[model samples]
Target: MGWNPFRRAPLLHVANDVGSGPVVVFIHGIASSSITWTNVIPLLAPGHRCITIDLLGFGGSPAPLDAQYTLPEHVAALARTIRSLRLREPFVLVGHSMGGLIAPRYAARHPGGCGGSCS
Candidate 1:
């Protein structure tokens, strides 16, 4: 909805990046953004690299005119975002509410890409 000042241009969809260990991806619920994990991220950050996502059209990610916001579309956008990050290994996926529904679908589609449980 607004310009993202958190991360760089392309990675605006992602939230924080802290600590140095295994990765943990967080997907917020409908109508929410990565900020949903503000409290939780710090706890995990101590032992992991926290990467929260702003689902398409929510949070800091832009909402384009041509993109139809759907479950598939959302997942695809997320995939693109993750690919751009170029992480060294698979990550743990965590979601809340609608995001909870989306995470498993992403995990199912990319089985090997997910190293940990989709919580």
Candidate 2:
């Protein structure tokens, strides 16, 4: 595994490099960051490469003061992060809360990925 950077406008963050097989990107809810999945990462890291990012305006990622934090903005941010990381292979997306909505939109825009809503 190697280091990769993802940046878009006011957002910038890191994705962990782990495992040997496919990749699984996890998006945390509004007000949360990559560390939100800390407990789950250890379990999944051995088998699948996992990515957990701080959404723009949260945690380590920066936010645009002039921009609106809408659903579409989040979806676009997630997509940008994925592409910036150059993750071309099929991957699974797990998101929580508002992220649940953003993840499905991303998967819909980019097929072969799975995403669902959660409380």
Q: What TM-score, over all chains together, does every model reach?
A: 0.82, 0.80
Q: Candidate 1, after superposition: displacement of residue 82 in Å?
A: 0.7
lDDT of each candidate versus the true structure = 0.77, 0.71
lDDT (10s digit) by residue, model 2, range 15-58: 56577678888888877787888899899988998888788778
* Top lDDT model: 1
| C-alpha RMSD for every candidate | 7.0, 8.4
lDDT of 1 by residue, 6-117 (tens): 3233333777778889998899998788889999987888899988889988888988655556676777777767777777787888889999988998888778774232
Worst 10 residues of 2 by lDDT: 1-10
- Cα error, residue 88 of model 1, in Å, equals 1.4
Error of 2 at 60 (Å): 1.1
Per-candidate clash tally: 0, 0
